[model samples]
Target: MLRDIDPMGDQASIIGGVIEFIKEVQQVLQSLESKKQRKSLSPSPSPSTPKSLHLPAKPNPMGEVGACFNSSLADVEARISGSNVLLKIVCQQIPGQILKIVAVLEKFSFDVLHLNISRMEETVLYSFVIKIGLECQLSLEELATEVQQSFFSEPVFLNEI
Candidate 1:
């Protein structure tokens, strides 16, 4: 199995590179946060005196905040009811990731009831209904967490029941 290879030679190097990349990303996030705090400490340069300079600025029609780009994974949703769990995932159009999700379910011993998939442009949406046996002995939270970690994205649950 890929997870079972000894982490000493080539695998070690790859793991090290990933760790270094994560550290770099964390540092960049921290730096951005510090810059944001610094900018919040001071007011912007005021315009020259005008007839009604003291009046407050008008609200923007668009929004109060600027636009931001998020490169994170698409959304994943899950819910459990009476020994059954349903998962809805929006992911990149990657076949391997979908397979990986199935593997995760198989690994955890869940019986899949239904698998539905749809695509729009570059994204794929998946809906899965799975049945969990009492013998599985895993809580809903644990199961949801496992799915999230396995997919490397947060899974939103709809009314945890």
Candidate 2:
């Protein structure tokens, strides 16, 4: 006899977490490969053709760092005003991801005021507005850098797209 499946139970949650972890691992590996390719030259030996006869290969428009955020993956943003800080992170479902983010926030002296978590398919979106007491002393730039460094393995540059 076939048993009924419950999507809200522990077993289902464990499987989903495993799938998310695997996806993140694959993303990191692909990023490493792209970096290596950008750093190394073509392995083929030099051709005998005259320099005038051969055309130079076009460079990769994306360059060495490549795309930092994939639309299908994740995006992180931080907004600051006085002692109020708002952080928005939209990402694929990752195991213990929210806890990790919260831990980092605590280290930076930001107290979580409110948190909203919404799920779409396998993605989890987190919206947090935090408050820092007068005693908390960290500039916005420093806070932003710390957030990226703790949450991301790669160096992230903010660009308006």
Candidate 3:
């Protein structure tokens, strides 16, 4: 249901703001914990003060979430296997994107042998196995270039598989 909401709209902005706030809070908490540790190390704590009074430091999940948000989702990898070409792609979910991909494959005259699509949160991964007919004469490098250009607008990581 959350995916139904546009990421560029008000709800997305609100979520972004919340994530920013959580990051700030996590930073402050980490700094306070470090300062507490330093103070405890320098001055001798009184015997009456229980050593276990301070809570254990918890891992910061916000930092990991922020990193995930900041990183690019688009990626493309291709490999040759006998008469078939294996292609793996990761791109942000968008309307009409799948149709566009199918169109691109058609444009290059690739016969789809097998296709698998998986959606994870805001991104989608597409794994395609295709056969290049004798009519299609594009080289692997050229195919990579065309797919990189046609697949998504974001920076894509293209690698050989």
Candidate 4:
């Protein structure tokens, strides 16, 4: 004899499982949508601002630096002297945290020349190339030290975005 199945118990189990699955899907969808929104909201440079801007030249440490009456010339020379420094960093995927990295660069007087980001399964990797001008007093070592001390000190989560 086949025992009759309890319809109420079976129905309740199915309904409960469906509800749980729906909640999980909602959470994952929300996370992905938030990430998209954060990326879209990032501020882009204005058209008026040139792709590369230069700082004034300074004394070469061993020789006197010549002055140029034209500000454009001075700007161009400064940029020519200050090439970009490339760095790679890996961190937990987080939204709105790029600003913190930018802040660190600004603190060290490094101009952000270019930035590229890649997202892996569990990590967000940043590749940044920056230029430091002669006007900036900090050396490469000092800048790197400061950035490491400030930005990489703690693990960052994506809760802010």
Our model 4 lands, by Cα RMSD against the true structure, at 21.3
Q: Extract clashing residue pairs from model 1.
A: none
**In order, how many clashes per candidate?**
0, 0, 0, 0
**Each candidate: what lDDT?**
0.53, 0.53, 0.55, 0.49
What tens-digit string does per-residue lDDT give for candidate 4 at 12-70? Answer: 67677568556545544444554456448765444343233222444656443322111
Model 3 TM-score relative to the real fold: 0.48
TM-score of each: 0.46, 0.45, 0.48, 0.40
Top of the candidates by TM-score = 3
Which ranges of candidate 4 are over 4 A from the true structure?
A: 1-82, 152-161
Error of 3 at 20 (Å): 36
lDDT score at residue 140, model 4, on the 0-100 scale: 42
lDDT of 2: 0.53
Candidate 2 residue-wise lDDT, 38-105, digit = tens:
43744432333211111222223433111122222345555564456766666657665676677678
- Runs in model 2 with CA error above 4 Å? 1-73, 81-83, 152-161
Candidate 3: worst-modelled 10 consecutive residues by lDDT: 63-72
Candidate 3 segments exceeding 4 Å error: 1-73, 152-161
